[model samples]
Target: MSADTSAEWFDPDTTTFGDRLAGARELAGMTQEELAKRLGVKEKTMDDWENDVRDPRAMRLSMLAGLLNVSLLWLLTGEGDGPGDPGVATSYVRGGIQLMEEIREISVQMKLNAERLVRVEQELNELLRADDAGAA
Candidate 1:
């Protein structure tokens, strides 16, 4: 948690540079292979960076921050603008689920309404035919 009681997505006290790197990469919706390919590094190299077995060069670090859409300072120290708190992600997922459920309900209602409309049309056609036959 920070000074204001908001839980940070990444706590510098407990997490290492590798942890931050991996977290940011995942949030960016990237696999290690994709990121490594974009960064012109081997998959093993990216794994090394994420495993704390090696660090990136300064230029590579800058590219990484830009590619991940996180501030370089945050990537290094977990203090500046990075991914927001984990709560935000949870809320987003919850909202998505609610929307999906609503859509499903609406779809069921529409199907029922369509069936009723078909029945009404058939009844109307039958009445018209009976009237025509009586006139004839």
Candidate 2:
């Protein structure tokens, strides 16, 4: 847990340098041991970095950024939009907005379904009531 960052930023595409390292490992479907194996690093060294107990040197940072397909500027300063952006960040923002709109539409449909279920239940109850009255 980084004191400076939100937990929502656990993805390498959206976090500070150290946290991004952890996220990149996850995105690559790598355990710390697996990452270590690939990087020729000891697992303890990887752990130390993830835990924020140590920082990587420039060469290691460069290697990590390249390996993860992210920008050094993003990894170092968290300054840019993200790795998913092209030369400019407009497309990423547009993509994110589009995804949000999609989720909103789904949410509206879910609410409508819930309301329909309630109406169905009420109709069934009325049918049962009518049947009981006729029997009595």
Candidate 3:
């Protein structure tokens, strides 16, 4: 069986460099942290590039294209060759990628919730101490 190629993910003309970079990275089944580690940069640096807050330098851009198995021109201008055949296993891989992304998002949310809980606890403790002093 062959994978469907009839549906293109995005129009090349309309896609931005950051969009291409992110899509290629996801298709390559790499997390941002993993890609950053391989490129000898911080994960926040990769996030910045993917979010369009910053651009990768020429050397790093070339390396990203190579690592993601895409053409340099495609990564930059969304022209030239793109990713290769995803193969029959692509569906399973894509599912895994989605799950991983969801997990990462949830993990971030959990951390935020924990921080909020800590602050609330601190506030309650302060209020109880004030009440005790008033009663004394």
The candidate that wins on TM-score is 3
TM-score per prediction, in order, is 0.56, 0.48, 0.57
In model 2, which residue pairs have backbone atoms overlapping below 3 Å? none
Q: What tens-digit string does per-residue lDDT give for candidate 3 at 5-121?
A: 324654787778877777777777778998888676899999999889999976677667767767788888888878654431122222344345445655766899999999999
* Clashes within 3 Å, all models in order: 0, 0, 0
Instruction: Report, for every candidate in turn, its global Cα lDDT versus the true structure.
Output: 0.74, 0.62, 0.72
Model 3 off-target regions past 4 Å?
1-8, 85-136
**Model 2, range 25-119, lDDT digits (tens) per residue?**
55544688976765557899989988788988665665566555555677676655344422221111223433454456557668999999999
Query: Global lDDT for candidate 1?
Result: 0.74
Ordering by TM-score:
3, 1, 2
- Note each model's CA RMSD in angstroms: 17.8, 16.2, 10.4
**Cα deviation of 60 in candidate 3 (Å)?**
0.2
User: Poorest 10 consecutive residues of model 3 by lDDT?
Assistant: 86-95
Q: Rank the candidates by lDDT, best first.
A: 1, 3, 2
Worst 10 residues of 2 by lDDT: 85-94
